[model samples]
Target: MDRVLADDLHALHSLVSGLRRDIHAVTAAFSTSWSSGQVEGHVTRVKLLKRMGFGRANLDLLRRRVLRSP
Candidate 1:
């Protein structure tokens, strides 16, 4: 944490500080055999589509987009 915070990159420092819990989760995952990759991929894809459609996308459109996405 100190090393990441000490780095000159502001994005790295901010990301580490802002997503502390996520970082901890990632560290825990690294030592485990189990993976949340599929769930995470689905969530990430949906979030991006939702952001892109924002006000225009209704639930149906979002669902269609999610279904259409690889």
Candidate 2:
């Protein structure tokens, strides 16, 4: 009975290990080149521009201002 239980546990572990490897393969294929670091940097710049403008600008103007300034 003990040997049978051990064999079952070993089979479960192997199945879980294979699933983990497959998940990793899928994730690697779907990973992005643009990371959170770059995104956060752009967000920080946008906030600074927004604050400096004193909340009076329209979206088109703001977009032009942000894009043209740099």
Candidate 3:
């Protein structure tokens, strides 16, 4: 990181700074097997469904769509 900053590659410098700021998370991501992939997928799916039904979907319809979704 010091070397990167010294090299004055502004783009890489900013990226390294961000990685340094979140060093703990960066290390944990590399070290951990656990993830929120399933939860995130569900959230994304629900958001997509909601968007698809935009102005017309009521609670019941949304519930049914979620329940019926694969």
TM-score of each: 0.51, 0.42, 0.67
lDDT of 2 at 2: 40
| Comparing 2 and 3 on TM-score, the stronger one | 3
Best-matching candidate per lDDT? 3
Which candidate ranks first by TM-score, i.e. highest?
Answer: 3
Q: Write the per-residue lDDT of candidate 2 for residues 3-70, one digit (tens) a residue.
A: 54467577677666666669876576579564578879888999888887776877888788789876
Error of 1 at 19 (Å): 17
Query: Which residue window of length 10 is worst by lDDT in model 3?
Result: 5-14
> Mind giving the per-residue lDDT tens digits that candidate 1 earns over 1-70?
7888887887788777766858777777788899788999888888999999999878999889889888
Once superposed on the true structure, which residue ranges of model 3 sit more than 4 Å away at CA?
67-70
Q: Which residue pairs come into collision in candidate 2?
A: none
lDDT over C-alpha atoms for residue 29 of model 2: 59
- Model 2 vs. true fold: TM: 0.42
Which candidate, 1 or 2, has the higher TM-score? Answer: 1
The 10-residue segment of model 1 with minimum total lDDT is 17-26
